[model samples]
Target chain A: MENKSIEQLNDICSQVRRDCLRMVHGVQSGHPGAALGLTEYFVALFFKEMTHNNQFQMDGKGEDLFFLSNGHVSALWYAVLARSGYFGVEELGTFRKINTRLQGHPATEEGLPGIRIASGSLGQGLSVALGAAQVKKLNGDDKLVYAVMGDGEQQEGQVWEAAMYAAHYKIDNVIAAIDYNGQQIDGPTEKVMDLKNLKAKWEAFGWEVIDIKKGNDMEAVLAGLAQAKGLTGKGKPVLILLYTEMGYGVDFMVGTHKWHGIAPSDAELANALGQLKETLGDY
Target chain B: MEKTLDLKFTYTEKKDTRSGFGDGLLEAGRQNPNVVGLCADLIGSLKMGAFQKEFPERFFQVGIAEANMIGLAAGMTIGGKIPFTGTFANFSTGRVYDQIRQSVAYSGKNVKICASHAGLTLGEDGATHQILEDVGMMKMLPHMTVINPCDYNQTKAATLALVNHEGPAYLRFGRPSWPIFTPKDQEFVIGKAWKMIEGTDVTIFATGHLVWEAVVAEAMLREEGISAEVINIHTIKPLDEEAILASVAKTGCAVSAEEHQINGGLGDSIAQTLIRNNPAPLEYVGVMDSFGESGTPTQLLEKYGLNAENIVKAAKKAIARKMSY
Candidate 1:
């Protein structure tokens, strides 16, 4: 797809929100809160930001690669991957179904078109992205590697291990984003486990940090991603601290961690669909 | 009478199996440009120095982070680079099992997890570093190929052979210098057991450091006129059932030996095979559900009953049980 205008990207974002709600509601088992909040970021990435091929190849040679570290938001990833022409958009109906490639977490086991690694166990994707980025450097491929993780996932020690490694090695060909929604399964990240000074933490670990103040806004996300892209290949990995609401599109779902993993009831689904416009038509 | 292969063997040198891995890795890097090496601050311990020196661009020194090293190795496989991650067996498996399960095995990334200093043979580092359950842990994961080669020659050959195996694999070797009896130019085929001696009384299935011990047991049994079949079961996961069953069909009883715990090591795999296919009398020679301690490799092996004397005793007991049955 061509570089979509901000209006087109926002339209895709709304459709993705609709897809995330319905997919979670259809299965009665999926993470909708983070998925809904991350819709705009995914839209900006697949539609307007990444230099990628919709015709997916596992190796992803000569093209940008994205790894979903916080794979609970797989509903958002699947929606955008389908809209960007990776596979049939109708396959969204098979989310979490038996024998479907759309697993509860993003996995490469079933040969999911856009997925290169299995992630859900948390705090592993950053290391993987750095590895892919290192491979890109080795192959003389100028393309970049991208990854997104949950703010709550920063508690994992392996994440810091990877953080230290990326900086210590001066791996500069990757851009990583954290879905800084400040909410997790139980409650707010602060009450659960405070991620104090996250930007300072990344900066301390030697990453160039960029904070998108309005991550839910499509234009802000696109510009933030572009800025992150420009910061790459300059001797340090770049991180975009995307500040999105946990459940941005729906009013009732917003401002609470209750929808983090639970599927919506019929009434709640209807409410969510009402808030998200049927812009590109629902899958 | 079962046809017995020549038992006479000779070795001119003794070397640590980790060196075999290092040499084979350098050769592999030379042969395939796609081969890359990643170490978790164990360059000298894992003998990955030559590879790092020759291919500095491809060698990744990922500090002391084994978890990130495993993930990085898995990620490197995306662009068709075959990554060989070097670390101690304990850190290689138990310390980062979730990473291996999710990023490497379940995701089906072609990664060579080259683990050295496995089992009680790690010696003096005590129980914390010596991991006896790595084979069991790795083999239980679906799509994982587990290989525990016996000596320097076999370990080196296994390292080179893994470059073409095309999937996730755990290459388990040890630190102590061992008898290099296996052919210097031997072809290492995964899952194919090498029958060193064929006999009718009993079969001894051995792997890693215990393979040489089983060879010595064969010689001891020869003096007692108790003909024994000694098979080096290098590849433990794809358990070489054909060779196992065929040998046991002739011998009627079996003995399993390894430098690991008896509960989940080679003995368990052999016993499972026997009970399912050909029920036979079997005995185990391994660490008996206990932790290792600070000691020399010889003391540790002897204390753990992972020696020729133990194999001989286990073999005789297995034969006696077969007669009683």
Candidate 2:
């Protein structure tokens, strides 16, 4: 990726937030809270941080890979993938539509570019990422495999299974990020299913845990990812607990569980879109 | 003019079909270095210890996490590695079906889900470990190939065959020491049926452990002044429609025997095929809507009506129905 200033990255994040709102509103059935919360992280990853090829290779050999384990945030990933030149920018309108590659959750079935696995069901992405990372190490690729999971998805027992597997196998090439927005579909994660001492949990699982206190801030996310990458190859896997506000950009949708899966109405969409600028021009 | 099938079939020894899978897996690993094995803490039980010992680096002990094992196998396919996941049929399919559906089958990853201890023949493990519905569950997936080899030799051949076949496949074998009747060098085809006997009266289609039972039923039917055609349906999915239709067209009636549940196992697949292509009188010889209990393999087979006597009864019933029609 070409060098982009922090202001330019922030402008891309604003555009991604806009894309998330319009895409979800168009379908009236997509996860918007996660898409909005992970906007800065996706932009920071696809635009400024990750060493990925936008040409959309499915195998992703000799290049860094990113897997969205919490696949409900397809709108955010689709926007970033398109913005990074993986596909046409206009294809964002087909999100969750019939016969479209942009499925409700990320998938490889529709031959979607930049996705290696089908991850809609929670707690499967980390295991897949570890597999890819192991293959990379075996092939001597030396590149990293990156992944992101929802903080609420930690309730799934398979996620811990993968965490233990990665640590036990010494899979030192993966940096797993979590969207710690504290909000899930029904209510807050703690009120629903408490994730008591998440950082301590990761540490106990034998991972080098990094906490990004301001995940919405583009600079902090970029640096936190860098810090996670820095911790790789030291005989352990890396985990980043990225603290972000659900629907960070939209004022009405911010910091609540109600906006997790519901799309904004016409009036609400107008209000939400009004807050997010069309910095990179609407897709 | 017809080619009369006359061949002597005998087994000098009895071996569990899972051992065939282990030997076949070792051969597959030798033929291709990219072939890898992963087990969920049942290496000894699943007969995967040989491959693990031969290729320790390629062998991954997933440690009781069937879901993770499936996902990891799916991921390994991206780097051109053919991963074979070993576990009990129940844990392999029912426990981690969603993982297989999403990661491996739906994604079209080239993963071999080699399952052992299938059906009621798993014996004293009872209804909990004996997975009679796995063949049905795996066959329903969009891009999954399901194979249930009848004997030890065929299980080994099928295991070796899946490495060359693309896409995800499910290979189901059992725990009991079955007869080693099939030739060791027999070519294992994916969707082709093996015609074991030729007859004009009724067609006996059997899979898994029940194939040998069908062979015995054929001899018994011959003594009753009725000819029986025994067809070994190893691959349940892709149902071998051509072979099935051709045989049923000749016999006019059919009997399906499997070591699985009658509701959704090989019987259901055969019935669906006949109902659409050629409607024929069909009788099922399998577990009839009930879970099994702790018993010896032979005790369970005899109690559940999964022996040659049951197949002969079903064959007679199918013939009677055909005469009524």
Candidate 3:
């Protein structure tokens, strides 16, 4: 975290956003809103802040552990895996297909690189991530675990249970991120179930709450990640409430829940693709 | 992951089926460093108090939250730890069915769902605690393997066997202490049925607490000149079809019994087996479509028509049915 520069991480974040957009367009299905918004935090962890081996095996013994709780944004995850050299970027086309190793959701069924659990059902990932982190601590691994949860997903009661458990255990080896995009499938999260004072809630649960403005701003996100890493193992769990715009890059998909589960038709995909440059080759 | 057991068991003492599960949990946790256990505040009832004491770090007391406990276990499976969840039979399957289906079954994670206090043998807890529909609910899941062990030694053996097997499994047992028949060293295979007695008139297939009941019925039928064959159908989902077919083909009549509702238990498993492989006249002896009341295990068995006499009556009735055919 100390050695990596913000500019390098910001460039990687741009590539990650491009990858997220192209993969969603290629599959014609996926959630782009939160994926684009949380690009910096994930990019910061993998590309700059965290220590991990890109060529992943089934077990992550000494390496850093990460769980994608909100698995609907699997297009972003698959692209990150490919770019991070866990697998080939060429396989991104096979995403959401019948025989593809990349299913519509994240899976470990095919030993897909970088995926430990299959998570399509929301509210289960946080607990699973905590369990993995607990295992790492038991095995005396000093490496950290990072998990991302959607702001809307916070409405689930299990999330609070996990939050209480982590803080009570002083699970400093783990860090959780919330994609506060202000929108879910139904509408704005405020209208659905207000998460007002959400960061304060985490604080009350004995967590060191960190706030990040402009989730897509790679530099600020990288700095926030560094601060988070510095706070590790301090006898408290840390939460980063990342402020982001839904469907960040694609103009038409932005500021709405319309693209949450809807796949782009040929026409919609072409329109979305027009906004994003092919930084990495298309699948 | 399947460790071949070297301990040769020669059962000299009777043990309850719930204690068998408790024994296997302690042994499995000792053997595998990755094995962890969870209970929804049923440490004393499920006889998991010993396991909890031995490995406090590996054990989780998830309060009374069965739904949250299931979700935690589902999440724990992701990080490559084998999570065994425990609760009452009714709460484990029905109360948190969606959690099991979406989290464990559909996700295809390796989880051992150990359910106790099953069937009418749950006694004074009445219909509330006794879960007769668990076997049916568990078998309905595509990836789930349902097992109902006969006695204490067999339950311990089945729990050990599930540690090596991958995928979601439902292991059910009762609260009361029943007959601990069968050899102690018998290997509990998932889908293999053990032939307890040989006969020529009718095949009696039984599971759970009723296995001992069926064995008793066999001895009683012998005095009446009816040679009733008995088969212990332990693993209900991956049912031992080979033995069932061979036994019923020779006997020409079958009677299935269990401490459960007649609609979806060992009776249904046996009937389906005979229907496809060997069409035989079958009569079932179990709770005849009603909820159980507060009574002793023996009294409940008699009240619900699950006793040895009912099985004997069903066997004689099946013989009459076979004669008509």
Query: Which is the better candidate, 1 or 3, if ranked by lDDT?
Result: 1
Pairs clashing in candidate 2?
none
lDDT of 3 by residue, A45-159 (tens): 7777777777785457787888888888788788777878899888887878788999888877667888877777777777777777877777777888888989899998778
lDDT for A183 (candidate 2): 92
Q: Which stretches of candidate 1 lie over 4 Å from their true place?
A: B1-7
Cα lDDT tens digits, model 2, A85-196, are 8898899999999999999999888887888888889999999899988988877889998889999899999999999999999999999999999998889999999998
Docking class of 2: medium
TM-score of chain B of each: 0.97, 0.97, 0.94
The per-residue C-alpha lDDT of model 3 at residue A21 equals 68
RMSD values, in order shown: 2.4, 2.6, 5.0
Q: Pick the candidate with the highest DockQ.
A: 1
Give the candidate order by descending TM-score.
Answer: 1, 2, 3
Model 3's chain A TM-score stands at 0.93
TM-score, candidate number 1: 0.98
Worst 10 residues of 3 chain A by lDDT: A1-10
Docking class of 3: acceptable
What is the lDDT for B286 in model 1?
88
Among the candidates, what TM-score does chain A have in each? 0.98, 0.98, 0.93
